[model samples]
Target: MSYLDTSDPQRPATAASDTNTAVTSHAPSDHIEMSEVVKKQSNGHGSVNVEEAQAQFHALARRLTRQSTQHNDKSGGDIEKQETFDLLEYLRTTSGKQDEAGFAKKHVGVTFENLRVTGVGGVKICERLMKCHDEFFLSPYYLAKSLVGGPSAAPKAILHSFNGAVHPGEMVLVLGRPGAGCSSFLKTITNQRGSFLSVDGDVRYAGFDAQEFGKRYAGQAAYNMEDDIHYPLLSVAQTLQFALKLKSPGRLLPEQTRAELNDEVLSTLLSMLNIAHTRNTVVGNEFVRGVSGGERKRVSIAEMMVSDIIMNNLLAANTCHQASRAVVCSWDNSTRGLDASTALDYAKSLRIMTDIFKLTTFVSLYQAGEGIYDQFDKVLLIDEGRQVYFGPAKEARAYMLSLGFRNMPRQTTADYLTGCTDPNERAFADGRSAADVPSTPDQLAQAFQQSKYWSRLVAERQTMQAEWQGEGDDPSGTKGQFLQANKEEKRKHVSRKDPHTVSFFGMVKTLVWRQWLLQIQDTVSHLRNVLKPSLIISL
Candidate 1:
C-alpha cells in the first residue's frame, strides 16, 4: 500500500490558539487581542471618560508587550513585518479621538474577516475544483447522482448513483432501493468504475484544483458496499491496520506513535457512530469466523479515520467537537462522581456545518415510521420516476396523507412504498384505476417528465444550459460527458486457448495413468488378503 502523491503546496498550520509563545512570538492569540483593543478604542469616541480611556490605553499597552515578547522569540520575516505593520496602522487609526466610531467599525470588520479566513484556511485541504467556468462547475471528487432506469439498467444505475458523503468524523446514510443506484454511486465516487462498468468515465480525485483537498482527503473516504461479510481472515486490529496501511503508506505513525493514534481513531469512530462495545470481538461467519453488520460498518469507518489525511480532515471539520459533547451523563450517588465540566468540554468540541441544499429523489428516501419522519431534514418522494412529494420529511408525509394515502401505525418505510403502488389503496381512496399506476420503465420515465420533480430538475438544467449550449450539440468532445459514441461497440478483447493442443491432452493422460496405478495397487492388496486367508485354513 502506498500513499497517493498530492501537489497541494499549502499545508495547514497549527491551530490558532495552540501555538507556544516561545516558538512563534506573533501568535494568533496576540493578533486577536490587538484587534480587540483597536475595536474598543475606536468605539470610544474622542470624548471618552478619563477612566475608560486610561483602561483602554493600558489594555493596548499590555497587548503590545505580549506581541513584543512573542516577536523576540522568533526572527521576523517579510510576512511577520507585514502583519506587524497592519496591526500598528490599526492601532494608530483607533487611538485618535476624531474618527473613533468609524475606526471602531473598520477594526471590528477586519478582525472578524481575519478570523473567518484563518478558520477556513486552517482545515486540512480535502477537495479542489476540477473544472470551472462562469456557468458550469465540476468537482474532481465524484458525488452520487441518482437517476431512474429500466429493469436492466436500473440495477447498474442504482449501484452507480447510490452514494453517501462521509466527511471525516460524520456518517452519512446512503438510503435507496435495492436497484436504486446506491452501489453504482459508491463505485463512481470512489473511481472504481472499471470493476463496476465495462465502460469507463472521466474520473479524477476531488480537490484536484486545490491540491490540499486531494492530499488531505484522498483516501479518507471509505465505502461499505452491500456484500456478504467473510469473517475468517483476520482480527479486528489486523483488519484496521491493513486498511490504514492502504490509506497512508509512508505517512503512517511508527509503533510508539501508533498506540495514541489508534486510541484516538478507535474512540472517535466508536463515539461518532454510537458503537463502542465490540472493540475486540471477532466477527462471526458461518462455520468460519466475524462481527455483526453494524460492527463491520464501524470497523470500516475506523480504518478510514486511522489515516493521517482523514484524521486531519475530521479534526478540521469539528466533528470531534460534536462526538465529544453529545455524552449521556449518569450520576452514581454512592460514588459521588460526575464530571460536568469535562462533559461540557467534550460537547463543545464537536461541530458540524449545516448543509444548505439537500436533494432527495423518491427512490432515494422511503417512509420509515411515523415520528421518525422528523429525524430527517429534507424528503423527496418519487413514484416510478416522477416526484410525488418533495419538502421537509414531515410535510411530505402530511401531504401524502391529505392526497388520500393512508398511513398505518408501525408501518416501516418499505411498507409505505409498497402501499403507494397498491391498486386497492388508490381505487378505494382516489377512484383511480390500475392503469394510472406506472408499470414499465418507459412509462415511469414519462411520468417523471410530467412531475414537479422533473420541473425542478429541468429548471436546474436550464440554468446550466447556457454554459455548454453552443459547445457542439452532438456531444463529441465534452470533457466530463458519461455518454459514449455508440452502445454496441465492443470496448474490450478476450483470447481463447486452442482445444487441440498436446498440453491439454497430456493433462488428461496423466490423470488417467494415476487412476490406473491406484487400481492395480488395490487388486494386489486384495490378492494378498485372499492368499493369507487360504494359508491360515491349510495350516
Candidate 2:
C-alpha cells in the first residue's frame, strides 16, 4: 500500500507521467555488457533461482546468436556482433528485474470506489423513432423542449458503484457481455473519462487522484481500443520506432546512447511479443499485402508497451533509481483479430511484463480461454454495467455457485460467469426459484454489495488510502517521491508541469524524420499522385 519510499536505495527513482516517465540511469561504463549485469543481479538477489533464469537467458541468446551467424554467412559477414549483443542486453534488463523486490521497481497501484459511469446513450436510434428522417428533427426538438422545461433527469448509468483495486504486478480480467459496459469501465480507469458524460466516484493511481492523475500522468496510464490503427504502408519497426522516439526521454543512460537505448527497448518488445520476424514488414490494410492480421494486432500491443521503456533510460543519469516507471494499461478486447494461441501468447507476454516492471493491467476479453484467464490475478464481472462479482479469479466460480447459479458441465469458468449475465444462458440450482435468487442485473449487484467480498474490497481500499496518503502532519507518500523523480528527469527548458519527457521541438523533429522516411520508402506511391494530376490537366 505504500506508494513512495525515497529512503530506499534499491528502489528505482521512477515517476509516471500522463504521456511518459522521464527516468534515466548511469552505468559504470558506456559499453558494459548486460551479461555481466545479469550475473551481478543474480548474485545479489537471494530469492531468485539463478540457474533457472540464467538457463532461459542463455538459451535465447544461443538461438539469436545462431540466427545471426546464419544470416552473416549468407550476407558475407557484414552484420556485426554489436547489434546482437545490444538486443541480448535489452532482453537481460527485463529478465534481471523479474526476481527483484517490489521496492526495486517503479511500482504503482490503482483503486476505484463507488465508480459510476453515466452517458446519454441508453436509448438507441432505432428505438427512438419509427421513421429515420423524422427522428433527426424530433431528437433536437425533444432536447430543446426538455431543456426549456427544467433540469433533465440524470443520464443512464453505464457502470454503477463498482469497486476494485489492481496492485502493481497484478492483472485483472474484466468479464461482461457486449453492451454490458465493459469498455466503459476500462475507459474510465485509464483516464479516458471524456468518453462518458459523467464519472462519479473516487479513482486513485497510487496517491494521485482522478483529476490530478488525468492532468499529469495521462499516457503512462493508457487504454488500448479493440481495433488496430496504423499507417498501412509503415513497417512494423517504423511504426513502433516512431512511438518510441516521440516518447523518448531527454536524458540517456550511461551504458547506452539514445539510439542504443531505443534500439534495445524496441528489440526487446518485438522479441518478447514474438513479432521480431515481422519487424521489417509493413502493417498493411486489406488493400495492401503485408504482415499477417495477427502481427498487426501485436504491433498495436507493442506500441502501447513502448510507454514502459520511455522512462527507463532517463532516470538513472541523475538519481540512484535505475528503474523505469511502472505502467497501467487497460486493453479493450485486444484479442479481436488474434487466434486462440496468439491470444494466449499475448496474455503470457503481458504477464511477463507485469511481473518484471510491476505493471497494473486491466484486460477486457470476450471468450477468453483457461490459459489466458489464469494469467490474471483477479476478475470483475459486470451485468449491464452493474458489477455482480469482483474478487480473486479462482474464487469467482464458487461465489456464483453460492448464489444458487448452476455451472454447466464442460463450461469454462469465464464462460460460466459471463453466462450469469444472460437470463437465457444461466440455470438455477434445484429448489431455487426466481424469487429466491438474484436474476436481474440490479438484484445481482445488490447481492454482490451484501457479500463479504464487497466488505473486504471497501476495507482494503480505505486501509490502502489511509496508509498511502498518511494521516497527521507528516503527509509523506507518493506525491513527494513522484515530484522528486519528476524534477530529476525533467529537462531545464521543459515546463515544470508538462508531462512529456521529450521537448515539443524534439517530437516535431522525430515526426518530421518519420514522414520523410515514409515518403522515401514509398517514392513511387508519392509520385503517383503528382503524375495523376498532371495527366488530368493535359487531358
Candidate 3:
C-alpha cells in the first residue's frame, strides 16, 4: 500500500452534468461519490480552511504508521523517516486497497512549536574609520583596531521565539524580507542546523516527537532547497528512476510489482509537478545547458528526501509524490533567482499539485504575485523570525490596516506588509512619537507580541487544538482522504487601508537608477583624478 493513495477520490467537479447521463445507463457521472469530498470557500475559491487542514494532515500522518515494516536498516532522523514512508507507501499501493491491510495508516504529517534558534553574532565590534581617503591596511587606525583583536563575539539571534504550524491539505506561504530569518526557521524544523547555533524547539507529528515520528511514521515532511543541484550527464528520467529504485520497497515486493509501482510513481510525479516535458532530458549543470532554472528547481524538489524524492521523483520516499499527509517543507524562496513570471508560475504549479494530490506544503517566499499569493490556503508572515501573522492570507491586509498600516495601491501584498515591518518605511495613521514607534525586527516582533494580532494568533492556535481534541484526532473529511479535512469558518475582515502609491517594479527601477547614478559618479571622479595630473604636466 502506497503511503499516499492518489487513486482514491473526488476530482472537484464544477465541470460535470446529471440531467442526461451519458447513454442513460450507469450512475450519473457528475454525482458526488461516497468517497468524494466537497470543498466550499467563502471567498469563491474552494480553498481549504487553515485550522481544518492542520488537523487533517496530523491525523493523516498518524494514520499512515505501519505495524510491521520490511526495511529496518534505515538510519538517521532524515533517512529513517524516508525509509518508513517509502516502504509503507509502496506497500499501500501494491496491496491494492487504500484503507485495508494497514495501507491507510502510513500517511504522515508534521507540527512544530516554540522554535528558537541562535548563532554567533555579527563580524565586527566597532567602527574603524580610515585616516586618509585612499589608505592602506597598514594605517594607524587599522593597526589599532587589529590590536584590539576581532569584534566582541556575541550570539546572533537568527530565529526569535517562533511558534507556528504547517497543516496538511493547504499550501502555507512563509514570507519575509531578506535576512528575516526564513532560512533559519526552515533549517530548524528540517534538522539541518549547523554546529554554530543553539536550538530550542519541538517538532511533533500526530502528537509525537520528531525522532519518534521518524521511527514510527517517517518521511511525512520533505524539504525543497533554494539551490538546485543535479548531475550534468544523467537524464532527468534516469535521475528520477534511480531515486525510485533506491527507495522503493525492493526487498518485500517482487521485481515486477516494484517495476510497475516505479512506472506509476514516476509518471504521476512528473505529470503532477508539470515537469513531464523534461523526463528524457539530461539534468545539466552550469557547464552543460540542460533544463531551465525553473525546471532545475523542480528537480531539487524531486530530490528532497530519499523516500520523499521517490514521491517527487514519484515525495518523503515519505508518502505519495512526497506529500499526502506529507508536509511540504519548502523554503519556497527556491524561486527567488527566477524571474517574476517564472516564480509566479512556479507557485501556481505548486498550488495545483497540492490541491490535486491532497498534499500539505510549507513554503518560504520572498515575493508573491497577486495570482500566486491568492493560491495559497494560508500565509505565514515572519519578520526576524517573529510571527507577524498566521491565518487566512486574505485577511492579512485588513489585519495590518487595523494596526494602522495603509497599503500601497496595486502594490503586491507581500511587499506592503513586509515594508510595514521596517519602521522607516511605515507610517501609521494613528501617528506615533519617536519613542512610541517600534524599530528593528526584534522590536517589530515585540510589538506584534503585544498587539491584538499575536493574541489572535494564539487564540486561533488554541482554538484549533481545542477543536482537534473535541473532535478526536481526525478531521471532518472522510476516513482515508489524506489531505481532506474539516470546512470550518475562517476569520474574515474587510481591508481597511487605502492602496499606497508604490509598485514592486517601480521600486526596482528606482533602486536601479540610484545604483546607476552612483556608478557614474564614481567613474567621473576617477577620470577627473587621472586627468588632473595630465593637465598639470601639459601646463
lDDT of each: 0.30, 0.67, 0.51
Error of 3 at 257 (Å): 3.0
Which window of 10 residues has the lowest lDDT sum in candidate 3?
485-494
lDDT of 2 by residue, 1-539 (tens): 11111222221222221111111211112222223222212222112222233233333334333343323344434233334443335434643342232112345688998899889744433235358888777888879976787444557878889898777777899999999999999999888987678899999887788898778666567889998888888899999898877666554443346687577667766765667778888898888778877778888988987876545432222222322343778999998878765565567556655654567889999978766776677899999989988888877877787777765656777888999889888998778756777889988988888887888888878887886767323213354545544544544477757776667887788889888877886786668868999999999
Better of 1 and 3 by lDDT: 3
RMSD of each: 25.7, 12.2, 18.8
Q: Give the CA lDDT, 0 to 100, for residue 368 in model 2.
A: 86
Show model 2 residue runs off by greater than 4 Å: 1-105, 122-154, 310-326, 471-477, 518-523, 526-539
Better of 1 and 3 by TM-score: 3
Instruction: Write down the lDDT that model 2 would get.
Output: 0.67
How well does candidate 3 match the true structure in TM-score terms? 0.57
TM-score of each: 0.39, 0.73, 0.57
RMSD over all Cα atoms, model 3: 18.8
lDDT of 1 by residue, 352-442 (tens): 1111001111112232322222223334343332233333333333333433344543455434544554444332225433354453334
Ranking by lDDT: 2, 3, 1
lDDT of 1 at 322: 7
